[model samples]
Target: MCFVAAVVWSLWSAWHLPSWDRQMDLHVYIGAVRAVGDGVPLYEYVAENGDPFTYPPFALAVFQPLGWMSEPVARLVWLGATPVAVVSIAAALTTRRGIVGRRRQVTLTLVAAAVLMVSAPIQSNLRFGQVSVFLVLLAFVDALDLTPRPVRGVLIGVASAIKLTPLLFVPYLWVTGRRRDAMRAGASFAACTGLAHVMWPAASTTFWTDAIFSTSRIGNLAANGNQSLNGALIRVGVVPPERAAAWLVLSALVCAVALVGARQCHREGHTARGVVVVGCATVVASPVSWTHHQVWPVLAGLLLMAGPRRTRMAWGVVLLVAMTFSVGGWLPAGFARENVRLLAALAVCTWGLAPLRHRAPATVGLLPGVRLVVRPRTAMAYAGVVAVAAGAVMLLVRESPVAVRFETPDHRDEALWGAPTNGCEGYTSTLRADGTVGYACESAVDPVGGRQLNFGGGRGGSSGMVTIQGQVGPEVARLVFVPVEGTKALDVPLLPQPGPGSAPLRAPEHGRPEMITSGPIEDRRLPGARGFSIAATSTDHALLLAYGRDGRLISSGGEKLRMG
Candidate 1:
């Protein structure tokens, strides 16, 4: 059954791969390495889509080869490797400790891999081209006996060097009766950090001192995609100062509880369960755990199924349903639903870590009497159960479609790029009913008769020319760029819209999904919005003046037109 589900999912993913914006994070990874190669400051280098490099300096070094590859090649390599990592994780979880015979273990590993491939978090990782699954597999080396005992924790350390979250495992290894492995892991981490420092001293220093604490660089902490406890609290209206304190307190408490639970699980031989518990704790405690980082929950769900029959029927259902469905969306509070993954991880730690009164049998498969091959008599019964469960998930879960539908004014470039199309960095589409999206730099200018001028500019290349891009309001017929020092005024050209027979705008082949483009429409002249994209030869401040059709000044802003 799981194999069938996996095959179906593979087909579906392949079909949608072309339409979906693929591997945004992978681009950042490659871009960061390339930035270093180009002599750009690692932390200061921003991707074309406006994301800064947030990973450790060592990560850049690791991705240096990927930087040499073209975007398509890098994406292909990442997408292919991610599934292999998932399969490896499943194999490590199922095949270790010899719970079953070799053949049974192989079968169980395949089944687990199938279930994991279809899980929501894994799918999210694949979509974003994230490295969470690979890190998970790396952290499992010691626990699953996948490497030599002498170097069991080295991989965990290396993973930590790429990302700090796995560093939590060093102490975990210590308390779980692997003190030597813990020291080795810590030493390995230090060695990797030192290597990065030697390779790129300035970048390593910047990341360790400044960039590490700049959580905002990763994007909005309270965004729906952030499923950590800190993000959850912020969405619920906690101020930053108080949120910091509360988060620290809550994270400490969770870490304590989860660590204790993991220790118990480790001592009791449920090593995989223990590792997952620690991983869940890490996700919840982190300041920004994106949906892709919640991969541990799927593994937790699988482990939950391995418990006794009643426990499997009760807790197992609760977890798998929560994992499969967006449970937070059903809540009354708007932001509460966004933290469904966070809440689910907490629940997993709560159940997986709590001590048991009686020692349960360590059967690492599905419920008893459930076999890989079913008899003719029971085949119909299993099929009925599977059908009912599938039906329930289909009825209850409402997946947000990847497709976006919004009509921009004038409809020249119908497809908008980068999310939150508020017109700051590039030519963003605006509705222009009454409100301005605000200036690209500072100072907000009020809309004039439901008209807005959204403008931004920056240094283009080594030539030092500044490329300015903006969208002018329909109320303005003539737009002029006046240099703060020069006498000549450059007339900003308005981009023309597509004619009647022009091809309809299509979604991007590679990039983020089309952002929301529809804004309030009150003014009749809003449909005539025009774009301004020009290279300023001189790097100087300029004033943008918008003139109405009646030869009257519509709007003007000087600070908004500064050439960076």
Candidate 2:
């Protein structure tokens, strides 16, 4: 079943071949590798797309062979290799103890790989042709191996040399009473770094001395795609100036707690579970963990599934995985973007660490009138149950009633409604019958003078005592306003009008006002009296906001206006 699923997935992925060249991060890696091979100074070269090579110099060496191949061929090879790496990791995790048969081992490995491919993190990794899968496999093998300490350490060292995040595992080794392995891993890491320095002194110097700490090179740390605790706090309205200190304190606390849990798991003969927990903690504690860095949670889920049955931890893992797989349009934009997955990872770490009693073993029939104690049927059963539950939840969320609906204004309409409130407060929009929309947003000041609006998943938000107006056109609504106080008013187009019955409109192209073609106004029931609602996408970003007859600002779902 696993092999069949993997083959189908691979064929489908191959059918979408045009996207191979569009893997931005893979291009960055390829560029660095070519630069290294050509002796053109790796750190000094930037790709045409404005992305800099941010990985360690040794990573260039690791990927150097790809530079020799044509771009298409390299991409195909990389794509194919990812599934192999995923399968390898699964094999190591599932077959290490040698209790399972060879056929069962292969089936389990393929099944694990297939399930992971559906997750958002793995999807993102494959989309970008990232090395995350290979790195994950290396770390998993090192952490779960019962071999000599040096071999385990070497695997982790090689992984760390390619990407700095895996360095977190070295300390994990020490904390879990594997001091020799930790020391060997540290030495191996140093040796690789030293080798890189020898091969490309200039790039090595620049990376170690500056690039390693330059978060800007990696793009916006506070971007919605960054799922770290720091990113979450930033999304929740934490100011930039204090966000670093806040992240430091919070990351420390999370690490301390997670380490304690991981240590417990390690001592309890669940090394794989411990390693997975540590991996999750590392991602959560990092300053900027992209969506692809979240593979650890999936690993934890698999571990729980293959562990003892009828336990709370097992059920919790099932629910967590199910929730993650079910995540989609039903969630608030911000929550859907990153928070939900991050929360799942945190939950896995926490649950894995908790001290829960194991359930009694179940007996299964091996022969006539003969029963043998064994674990729950297999991870496949757990996956099947979760898949069914997730499908049901998705159906319900999709068919649920609209949260808010707007009423179309007749000739003249005047109503006041609060802003679509989420994470921020104190802003309102008013729709006038004169084909005009007015906003009376409170100034970004209360006790402290700063913006209070935390537009989590939206393109952005505005603050301060500001008054802005826009004329609603026959086909498009042009919103003109300055984002900050004392700035000139900028004209921006609203989304194309949506159809009736509260149906969602397709996202409009950015900066293309001509593309803002109008559609029939949705005739949805309002909370109060009859009024028309105009649903439109935000021009600045892929955001959906609706304005109703009153001052109703409806986001993903409509909200009842509170008349003041």
State the TM-score for model 2: 0.61
What is candidate 2's lDDT per residue for 1-564, written digit by digit as tens?
A: 766575567546643757534566887888778866776677666676556787898888898888889887887787777777777767777765354588877777787777777666776777788888788888878877655654768889989999988887887787676777887889989999999999889999999998887554565555667778777765554443355566676566556546556666776677777788888887888877887788887777777677566585566566446434655445766544557767766666655543322423334333457765533223224434653554354334322111222222222112322332111112334454676544332222121322111122211123111112212322112222222111122333332222233444331333233224332222321111111222222212112222322212212111111010
Backbone clash numbers for all candidates listed: 1, 14
Measured over all alpha carbons after superposition, the RMSD of each candidate to the real structure, in angstroms, is 18.1, 17.2
State the local distance difference test value for candidate 2: 0.58
Worst 10 residues of 1 by lDDT: 437-446
lDDT by residue for model 1 (1-564), tens: 676577457545743675336677887898788877888788877666556788888888788889778987787777778778888888888865456688888888888888878777777788778888888889976656578987888998999999998888887787676877888899999999999999999999989898898554565665777778777765554444455666776676667556656766887787888888889988988888887887788888777776656766577667777766677667887644677778778866645544432343232212345423213223334434653554354334322221112223434221222232322222234433467542111111224545467666665556455555666765667776654321234566676433222333332334234332332222222334566655555433345667666444456666555434
Candidate 1 Cα deviation (angstroms), residue 281? 0.4
List where candidate 2 sits over 4 angstroms from the true fold.
Answer: 14-17, 37-40, 96-98, 146-149, 311-328, 332-338, 353-564
Where does candidate 1 stray beyond 4 Å?
A: 1-8, 11-15, 18-20, 334-336, 356-564
